[model samples]
Target: MRTSRPWMTQAATRTTAVHIHHQTNDTTWRSYMTIRRAWPCLVFGAACLCPLPIQAQSYPERSIRMIVAFATGASHILAIALSEKLRESLGQGVVPDFRPGAGGNLASALAAKAPTDGYTLLLTSPTIAISPSLFKNLGYDTFRDFTPISLLATVPNVLVVHPSVPAKSLKELIALAKAHPHKLNFGSGGVGSGSQLGSELFKALAKIDIVHVPYKGASIALTAMLGGEVDMVVSTVPATIPFINSGRMRGLAVLAPERVASLPKVPTTAEAGMPQVVVITWYGMFTRAGVKPEIVERLNTEIVKALRMPDIRASFAKVGLDTAPTTSAEFARFLREETDKWARVIRDADIRVN
Candidate 1:
């Protein structure tokens, strides 16, 4: 065999000697040195993987800003109640920043571009689902720009008619509409408002053609109905309950799956033989996409907890809102369903907003 090189012989001898020493001596010091050599790598790996947990634990280190889609009305009330409750639970000021404009799009755009740090949140109604179909140039993608946290509450819309309309029930109204297609008309808050969509859904399912009269706001539309300016209207329970109770407006059916407690006598659309006409003004929480899952989970937990509180539930109910807390995944699926359903309704009805 060829003679071994000098460097190879030296390496073999050193390896043999180290092996012998390892076998004969205690390995505590050797192990310590090995760990010391790997300390930086171990720290780097941990730093990469452990940050989320650490951040989650220390989250809400400061006040949180809640962007309310509507400056006033049910949404604002819901935001104030939710913020006050969250402040109590999270020990941080959860401030409601009203950014109402452009049919709730201004607040949505602001929320979509907010940092994914869980500090800025959005409390909005179904406008998030309806805007993509109603407006052609929305600043944010409804599905892509936000992460749904939870559904806070819902207020069902009740279909009511002027006492002069002579429709005592949903069936009577449908028959009347079919009997006189263009003669019957319904009023709404605006062209793209929930009341309009609810009436459109009702029209599509019932196969009737009731002319639409859009007012500046739902309150105005209800007032018009009260004054017999419009034959029918789909309005929130709180706004129209007094009228219904006072016999100023005839409640045909509530556009929801179940009869509301406030209007226990009013049958739901489903009970009225049209299960597809359910339309409720829903409020939910959202954050910018890419927020850490841990933070989202924490927020959802606290929100659901706050919603279930007796005081919160009672407060919401006073305004005809029912506590409807849902998990994040469930809320996401619900949002998608709402978006698709409204999209179809808008397209079929040729609904558009300028």
Candidate 2:
């Protein structure tokens, strides 16, 4: 890591120059004598004050690019909302690039290759954690390729079905699947995506075999479910809430540990008797590995602050994302745990991208 900052040297030189001129002044000399008498305490205070210039100038000197590992629209609606808040708070432009393919492996690799100057970031979910085990040849390693920044939110997936489906509850759905194994199909954003994992976990816990139908994106997947192309879809509540309310889709159960505020009537997967299928989509921020620890801390603090804002909180709630922030270290540990947990699910369910 680079130990010296050019900006800090410039600021310190300016401070020292201004003080040198003041040394000749009578009033300044008297003040200097008083400070020198208390030099031990005064020096510590002075050094603390001197470092602000470097910190202010070094971070985000230019616009930042945040790569979203999903397509445009509902899949990334929450990310764009959070990015807008971050831009307002940091006073730097924030640009988002949505790269959708290979279950976000393409975007993750692109971010891993970018410079680790804090100018580039990745906005994504646990798929970054889950992909390494699912694909035989993923380009980048999640733990090795990036530094975990902060956790943005935990989005719960809802088990939604087309109104035409005979099953009205999770219990009934499982029974129906048991009666006709491999006949029911579940639509997902794509293979190895969070929706896929949610559905996979569901199948594992329920002891059922629902055919997986991977679509290009969430919209298409939801379209398939609504058109009866697929029997059910395990997706985020925000994307399916409108349809559920409109009677186009019915909520069989939520994959969250607890029922969501928006859908108080619906039961969680555990409440519906399958306690092992609890899965929620969690999004976290990341920068390429090798970014300074101080830079990571600064970004994390700002992001947490941005998420706490009333408008930002409301915007997140509007889209069914709970505004919860986790420290970088905490998020890193969580990522590892989630990766291990999902890896077991993928293996147990015999899930694979190809």
Candidate 3:
């Protein structure tokens, strides 16, 4: 309206072009930022869909700690052998850390509190199944806090008496106990040990009254029996094998379904007229609950493979143990049955521990 100058017209046109350029740049930058923010979400969704195999493949990044329930005896032997085999296959060190007390509860408690990661493993005996019934307070729930990996091995418990006892057979021992109710005494690893429970089950089944003398461990109890400090002991075949062979102790009967090769002369409880008196000391592997299924499967596979190896089997066999590997589901079912059976025995025998 004022003046139609060439310079003014040119200036207005240039201003319009600059405004358009700024608008275009702002729109492009917003689109880029939206994509950048969404990148992590897209990756997370993909991972959720296929996580198991990847997690398993990447697992066991470091050495694993195997908590041995007992420092000595068949459990320790099995642990060392199994750990060696696992180390070879898994390419990670499987170290045995002995925590022997409370009839295996100390190790169980420590294992139960460990992270749900696959790095911590527990190697235990039937005490795991027995503790729930024998103890008033436990730190972990057997079924809730643990995931069974596999049943590694089983050793037969033999009722062995010192050389001084006159009884030669299971029946003779029962009659002798009947003649003198509290004269004959039995030694055990501890109050709630498998040896004690096995002996209690025997007492309940045979209707005999024998005093129970608790020792720090089964080996100690066996030592006591050897020294004639205790009359008899329900001990593992391996611990009593040398003594029996050397005439230091007499094997009354083996508490198993079949007689062990190491003690072939020893009669099974079934064969000894007490079919209900079978007590097997078993070793199994477990990890804290909530571990990935893939990791569990991996461990189960490796254990099964290791147990099948001839050398491993031979090593265990030499010590009176049978390599009894089983799948996770099978072991879990077996554990449940063992727990129920021991619970009944504990309740009937009135066994209690603080």
- Best lDDT among the predictions, by candidate number: 1
Q: Model 1, 301: alpha-carbon shift in Å?
A: 0.6
Score residue 218 of candidate 3 by CA lDDT. Answer: 80
Question: What's model 1's TM-score?
Answer: 0.84
Please give, for residues 1-354, the per-residue lDDT of candidate 3 as tens digits: 110000000011111321211011223324434543463454346446765597787778899999999898788888888898999988899999999987689999999999998999999988898888877677989999999998888777889998899998999999999999999999999887889988987887787889999998788999888888999899877788889999999999987655667777888776778765667778899998999888997798788879878999788777777777666776787688678767867776677774
Cα error, residue 317 of model 3, in Å, equals: 2.1
lDDT of 2 by residue, 78-197 (tens): 567877877887789889888887667889989988997888889887779888888777788898889998777777778998888899899999999999999999998887777887
Q: How many backbone clashes does candidate 2 have?
A: 0
Model 3 alpha-carbon drift over 4 Å, by segment? 1-52
Residue 8 accuracy (lDDT) in model 2: 5
- The per-residue C-alpha lDDT of model 3 at residue 264 equals 74
For residues 1-354, write the lDDT of model 1, one tens digit per residue.
110000000011112321211011123223433543464455446546665577777888999999999988889888988998899988999999999998899999999888889999999989999999877778899889999998888777889999999789999999988988899999999999999998887887788888999999999999888888999998888889899999999999987655677778888776788765667788899998999998997798778778878998787777777777766886787687678777777877888776
Worst 10 residues of 1 by lDDT: 3-12
All candidates' TM-scores?
A: 0.84, 0.76, 0.79
The candidates, ranked best first by lDDT, are 1, 3, 2
The lDDT per prediction is 0.79, 0.73, 0.78
Q: Model 2, residue 275: displacement in angstroms?
A: 2.7
The pairs that clash in candidate 1 are none
